[model samples]
Target: MNDKVLIVGAGAIGGFYGGLLAKAGADVSVVCRSDYDVAKHYGYRIDSYALGNWQLMPNQVLRHVSEYQGQPDYLILCTKVTADIDRVTLIRDAVAPCTTIVLIQNGVEIERELQQAFPDNLLVSGLAFICCNRNAPGEISHLAYGKLILGNLSGRQEPKTQYLRDLFLGAGIECVISEDIVASRWQKCVWNAPFNPLSVLSGGLATQAILQNQENFVRRVMREVCSIADACGHPLPADIVENHIALTRDMPPYKTSMLLDFERGHTMETEAILGNAVRAAQRQSVDCPCLESLYVLMQLLELQIRSSSLLN
Candidate 1:
């Protein structure tokens, strides 16, 4: 097995994958900022109720991209959606000629941006089904859902993609190579569109925000997102709203990344989540009132947060 896996953006998703791959005996090198010391000291930890595990250390860890002596077999980019687009470029030159870039971020358009730079490298889109958060510098709490869906841009299964799937499956992670990755990505977006923003706005767990009996806000937000996806030629199922409602209900009390950023006083990824859908809908001449309202409301909320921070 190709042992070298470089996981960029050592955040929740990256750490989870790195930790699991490391436990599976892959030589995992993580690229992060100054927080590398904490990860190095504690190794990487994964806490899960569904997976019935806690904090497995990786085989290896590193701070800088330059510390990687040779090219990597796979580059797992798990940076935040709102991060600079140029960070991927720094690592693009470090990969082997046939290296696969598996993006495990939230937004749908990150693969497109990456493809423009490394056109020849195999750019894969992946959807993460876990509620992972960076509790502290080195600690990560993976509440539930450790399944992964991976596919190529053409949505075709090739030898390379299969190998990657096998690697993850061997590590005891549920890995699915789907022919409908676009739909899957959009499906995850449907799940995130409401829960992420609602958590940010209402300041609560995603399950709490969506599963509460009184608030139809969650359904309304997802309805608009589904409509927008349909308009952009994806046409997600109508029950997507209900599925998310149930999925969140089954999960434990957990805060979404959006709310975490809100509490930490960081900017929320409104454009990447809701704005991308709205832009696609407009391009395809579809109406998305709910998404629009959410976008506007978030922008206002962000502005208020900024103002309050400035005053303080």
Candidate 2:
């Protein structure tokens, strides 16, 4: 039988990966908000530099989770980790006993809420190392790298995790299953902690520009994150910092997801991406002056955005 997958937040990352699952013959469905009318009428248009262009017509394009017809085998959550939204409340109704909840979002220490919400169901922590964005309604542009890492949060090797990896592989994308997903989250944070906020703080600079101008500052922030990760017992690889810098230097000059959100006048994931890490550093007694400074600046920026939105 085909896997029934329901995507809760079908933006760029969700839409692109959900489309790939459809390509792998999963009965994919989406619950859209902003692009509901367009996705319901037409379908998602995926333009990938690596895999080429394609369209994904979901089995259902729903307005809310309650509107779903049946229980899905997998419920993938790809929403931004922000303070304004309640991630658990968004998908609580649709979770069944057998359903495996997968979170393909950025941030460290974000898994406990979902695990507590549905203790009986299996939860998978996912990370997407890709440069993808939503150009417009129902349109996704996959600009660069598209690798996925998924692992069970409880440290159990489940077959469903492997199946999901195979699906991405079959769709021509690289997907790996990790034994320690928390460590993977920390590793990704080593890059995200530096580039994401710096992109916005630099007044909408791309990754390349930020690296070019503030390479030293970026490395300091990354090292802070590594220290926090080590203190938390999820020590990263020795060469992770250099590896991320090299990768960023080689990739196309691209705007980060945080910068894109700031440009769109939307709420950025300041708390999730930076705030959480800073708090973790505090809990571990790790000195992260650079990371803490970035967090404060972002919080002020978010306040400014909110104030501006209120005025206009």
Candidate 3:
């Protein structure tokens, strides 16, 4: 039987991955809100780097997770982890006892919420290291890199985890199963903690621009993240900081997801990406002055946006 994969929130990351899974012969379905009409009629138009540009119709398209039919082998939660929505509540209805829930999102200290909600369900933590965007409804633009790293949040390598890995590999996607996925989460944070917020705080500048102007600032934040990770027993590579700077330098001029969110007048992921890291630091008695400042700025900006919307 083909793997029945149900994607919640078919945005850039969701569309790109779910579309590829369909192309790889998995039974992929998506629950889309705003792009329902566009995707259902025209299918997903994906411009990918590794799989080439292609369009394919998922097995089904429903507006909400409650409408999902049958027991999905995997439920990939692709929604943005923001203050407005409860991530656990969004996909709780669609989950079954044996189902595996994969969190393809960015943030630290997120797995606890899912594990607590569905203690029996297999929990997979995923991090996407790609520069992609949803240009329009039913559209995705994959600029550079399309790699995914996954690890079981429960610390067990079940057969399902291996199956998911093999599935992505079959799709020509580079997928890695980490020995310590929590450490991988922290490693990704090193890159995210700096560039994501910097992009938003720098008046919507792209990653390249921020690196050019404030390389030291970026490194400092990354260093603090690594230190905190070490304290948390997820020590990263010593050269990881420089590696990110080099990667950003070579990548095409691109706006980060957080920056894009701010640009679209949506709530940015301040708490998940920045706030959580700072909190972890506080718990460890480690100082993260730079991340704290960015968290404060992003929080203030979000309040300003909410206030502006209320007045208008």
Candidate 4:
């Protein structure tokens, strides 16, 4: 196996997963934007719930993909899929034919762009079921669960998939090999579509409070997401909604990543998680009232943020 892994966007998800891979003996190189100096000097400090506390100074800290000196085995793109960034373009130069580009990003209908951009190169879709936050430079707080599901968009397992799974598993993390990554994206959207937006719209309420005070609204949004998914030809598991509810009930009272992004005055992932889902529903003529409403609200919020930024 090619033991070298390059982590682009060294923030919460990137730092946590990349730190573990480096700890597991992979030749991991991390590329950071904001925390470049800190990552270069002090390395990453990951306080994981599952893997416990760990730190890494790989000696290969890079500020951008252009600084990478090797043909990487895995170029993991852990950046947030937002309106301001063209994800495919960011990883263009370093994406060799041998590189298995692992996109551990959140969004529906996001894989096609990269797949089209690099047809010959291997693409792996990753879903991170964890509550992690990077409140400051060189620091990652992994608050809760950290299981990862990985698969190609083609709906089949490749040899590379097993290698990636084993790589994460070797790092003392629970990793599952998925069959249909397309469906998996939609499945994740069920929970993401509602809570992420409502958390921000509700004047920054935490997960527990949102569920406690607005259970019915949450359920309705989830059901709408499921319906949209089914119309798009990927029916989710029957009890996934209940599973999310129970998971949230037992989860620590914490702010979501989207909420954190808004709180920190950064761009929230409004379009990827909610906008894409709503657009897909519209194509299939499926009525996603809840999703449509949330998308509009988030767009307005994003606009407000932009206007405020201009004045400052």
Model 2 Cα lDDT, one tens digit per residue, 66-136: 89988999999998888777888899888988899999999999988888889898899999998888999
Worst ten in a row by lDDT for model 2: 264-273
Question: TM per model?
Answer: 0.88, 0.96, 0.96, 0.95
**lDDT tens string, model 1, 90-137?**
576566786888888776555677788788888778888876777778
Instruction: Give lDDT for model 1.
Output: 0.75
TM-score of candidate 1 versus the correct structure, residues matched by position: 0.88
193-267 in candidate 3: lDDT tens per residue? 999988987888988888888999999999999999999988999999989899889888878888878888877
Off by over 4 Å in 2: none
Q: Please give the CA lDDT of all the candidate structures.
A: 0.75, 0.92, 0.89, 0.88
Q: Give the lowest summed-lDDT range of ten residues in model 4.
A: 50-59
Question: How far out, in Å, is residue 1 in model 3?
Answer: 2.2
lDDT of 4 by residue, 122-160 (tens): 899998988788878999998877889998878778898
* Candidate 4 pairs with clashing backbones: none
Q: Which pairs of residues collide in candidate 1?
A: 46-55
Q: Pick by lDDT: which candidate is best? A: 2
* Segments in model 1 whose C-alpha atoms lie over 4 Å from true places: 50-60, 83-85, 203-206, 209-215, 307-312
* Candidate 4 local distance difference test against the native: 0.88
